[model samples]
Target: MNPYFARSRNDRLAVGTFLFGTLLAVWYLMCVVLPHYQLSSDYVIYAHYATMTILYFQSLANFVMVTVARPDGNCKALQRNQQTESAHCDACGIVKPPRSHHCKVCDVCVLKRDHHCWFAGCCVGLRNHRHFVVMLTYLWLAAVYGNVLQWTFVGDQLGGHGPATWFRIVAPHVALLTGHVTAYQFFVAVMTFVGLLCLVMFSWLLQMQVVQIYHGQTQHERETAVTKYDLGWRQNVTCALGSRWYLVWISPWIPSPIPDDGYEYRTSAKTD
Candidate 1:
């Protein structure tokens, strides 16, 4: 594979910038722009609430990581020869490994059976799962933090005045005046709406993660339980995060298990 295609350092940097810009832009509007026009207090409150809600989502994502085992890289499609000791896969003409499955997206058999993630634009397989979870969870936290900062700053900027009093004071001067609300107020309302959406999505993800954790499966595994062996929660967690999580995360050179060449066919033959 081309190094560039596998999410290079520059790609990470670019994605990071986009995340920063997206979250910061939403926050800036809530903090500076909405408050300047003296928007509704409820808007700011919702933003603050949204900011704190992301912790749950991050935890949920971690749980999902454990639930979903990734596919191995040694899977191949085959025409079954029931009687043969060693069967050949016509698709790749290679033997499929034990616990391997063909990934339609990757167009190859993967070992271990983890799911693909389109949002990350990569497979959430063993090699990348840790970094993927870290990236996703951190981004979720950052989004929350930004909105929290936004609402808190907005409150500080506006002082302790009541919404009603401020609304009355700003009414005549505010643009886009409706019978019920001024332009500034409406902008804040919009910010609140966006914040609420974020909160809902995060919350739903959290709930799903918790549910899967309790059931001892990831979304993928839950769906494919009939064919796949559910490794249970403890093994799933250890395999994804590593048995020594502290060392796994800290060490830069720790090697992961690699599939032995032709073991796929050998294992399959024994099973057959």
Candidate 2:
């Protein structure tokens, strides 16, 4: 099968899970969690959902920008600068910049290669690196927020009697088929579980990315303990994000142009 076809088919699971989880979360929150919170305070609901909406919108924007920014290596640009050694990638049929590598999945050489992200379905590299990191921040926040709200708000709404909750947790479908749970109960249980799972996954990725950004290293660099570009944390962040990172660290919509062309990086004294 074509790589694109295989990727699309594989990604359907992620897409479907995302859609289903979003729908289920909304339904449960509106029908169940909302009323509970509303009884406590209207401001809580307003603030709760307003923040959630902003996070989601920002996440959507970040996702779009990352996808649009495709962090492919600037081979022509590098050819002009000649800042460092160049490696010809037979796959991409071009001379890639130092620290750049070709992604077999993306079928392109990427600047400052991090890795091919299965979730994003893209090769994260120089240009989109900031957007990718910002995207991860927002998504991680969203996952954490969703999980907390789901568990705290609806913790009581799962199964009321005996091991019904555990049963639903382990086998919602089986519990439903056996007439041990209502469809609504089954959905609540499954969605809450999924929210926790997402939280765990996003937490790990975000943590790793944070360390990499702080150390001025890519995923590959971190793996090999490469310290060539391990500039100070502040400089490292500026390199990945931009000069005005202080201003736009919270959101990706703000502009903060990266200080240098991806062809050459500011090396650390540790490596020199």
Candidate 3:
């Protein structure tokens, strides 16, 4: 009912749509156009198809998890006494859990709040942190893969035996499709540029997330110099990625159970 919540939801929906649509378009390009032009070997073509399929579905699952999985934000259940100082949020008038911070955009407290991602149009917090990291990882991989494939295809078209010019390569595809350089080819050209940019950006993001997880810190916690939640590297990674983390990259469908409930977490001081 709140305007802030409404605006945040709308932004999330719009961004999510854009992201999902972009990925779907890339999948179509890779599965449909790529194999026809780039590969002569059946094995390579089939492998490309399989790669695109996994990336598409995994990306979709990650996007869904990031969008729908919200923190409970109910601090009252954890608070045994009304007078507890850390138990109350002044803004939302709810009990605040440890490591939770109030997100102005979402208008609620988020458990283990990392950062409010404008691209995701949501707060990166407890329940969806794993999903967020996995999304970035897969998206980066997809971008890198797309860039390499596009580069090779463009090079072959441009009369170069290896990587070569952009316009000289793309102009033929555009002209063949519509007798002249049409919007479709232009769109592909733009995506080629975007793919490279995303490859670099997401690579940096994934690296940052890995470093943060290794040190058992969220973006907020790192800024605030809070290390109470640092539970050693392995346990910290396990906490973020869940139990079956090794298989998380292969597929989002794989069961990777988060150890904590978001409301309750084990700090460095406690063993149990």
The residue-by-residue lDDT of candidate 1 on 1-272, one tens digit each, is 31212144544564455445455555565456545555568867676546544443443354334324333432333323232334344555555544444555545554444455444433555555554444445545655665555564444433334685345335423423544545655555455445545656655654554444344344565565532323455544554455554443333235443222223311111111
**Cα-based lDDT at residue 259, candidate 1:** 26
* lDDT, each prediction: 0.46, 0.72, 0.71
* Candidate 2 residue-wise lDDT, 2-51, digit = tens: 13211454455654555465556656666676676555777777888787
Question: Each candidate: RMSD to true structure?
Answer: 10.1, 3.7, 5.2
Cα-based TM-score, every candidate: 0.48, 0.85, 0.78
Lowest lDDT block of 10, candidate 1: 263-272
**Model 3 lDDT on a 0 to 1 scale:** 0.71
Question: After best superposition, candidate 3 residue 138: deviation in angstroms?
Answer: 1.0
Model 3, range 97-127, lDDT digits (tens) per residue?
6678888878777878888776766778887
Between candidates 2 and 3, name the one with more favorable TM-score: 2
Using TM-score as the measure, the top candidate is: 2
RMSD of 3: 5.2
Candidate 1 achieves a global lDDT of 0.46
